[model samples]
Target: MTAALWPLQQAVYAKLTGHAPLIALVSGVYDEVPEDAAHPYVTLGSITEDVDDAHNQRGLEASVVLHVWSKYRGFKEAATILAALDTALDRQPLPVAGFKDVSVAHQQHTEVRDPDPDIRHINVSYRVWLTKS
Candidate 1:
């Protein structure tokens, strides 16, 4: 069976960047944040994948993390961005390369206190299931 992590990440990136509402809320969606990256942006975080094989077919389950960063005074800014991110991916149809029957769902999320008091962060996770095509 083929590895689905890269393709899945690409698909998620495309979905978030291409969504008008989501894009309007953030500077950009990035795999690697730039040194001069702006505030109120989204970054793709770690991924964990596992084998979930079924009779006569190969399946994979992946958990992807997305981080929302904002310099806004309160958690409200990060939360709004989180909502947009969730709406963009949760239960949304994603077309991943080399994979079929793909589905994404919101797993869980939490607020993280950055050491730098000025920064606010919200970490969100999504569960993705796909079958090798």
Candidate 2:
């Protein structure tokens, strides 16, 4: 079995970082946000994979989550970022290094009011399906 997480992530990163709308609206999208990072940025979050042994092919299905962090004092900015994330990944074709027919889609999302009150966060989950080449 092969893990397609890295490849999918790379494709997604490229999409988001290259998007002018997303870039202009937020500080940036990151796999790991740096310390002292500016507000209004997106970060890659947890990923869970489940083995998918099919008829004769080994496959994998994964749930990947992303977090949108903002300090805009309201949900507006966070929602905007979340929309961009959805546009970038939902039903988008992701090219995985060692896999073929990779597909990713927006699964679910949640808006949370952080305890800090000064910050807002939205968590989005994506479902990915891929088969070994």
Screening candidate 2 with a backbone cut-off below 3 angstroms (N, C-alpha, C), the clashing residue pairs are none
**Candidate 2 per-residue C-alpha lDDT over 1-133 given as tens digits, one digit per residue, 9 for 90 to 100:** 8777677677778878887878888888888789978999999888888987689988899898999999997799999988888777889667778887778889999999998989999999999888888
State TM-scores per candidate: 0.97, 0.92
Residue 86, candidate 1: Cα error in Å is 1.2
Model 2 misplaced regions, further than 4 Å: none
- Clashing residue pairs found in predicted model 1: none
Alpha-carbon shift of residue 16 in model 2 (angstroms): 1.8
Worst 10 residues of 2 by lDDT: 3-12
Candidate with maximal lDDT? 1
The numbered model that scores best in TM-score is: 1
TM-score of 2: 0.92
Segments of candidate 1 deviating more than 4 angstroms: none
lDDT of 1 by residue, 1-133 (tens): 7788788889999999999998998888999999988999999999899998889999999999999999999999899999898888989899999989999899999998899999999999999999999
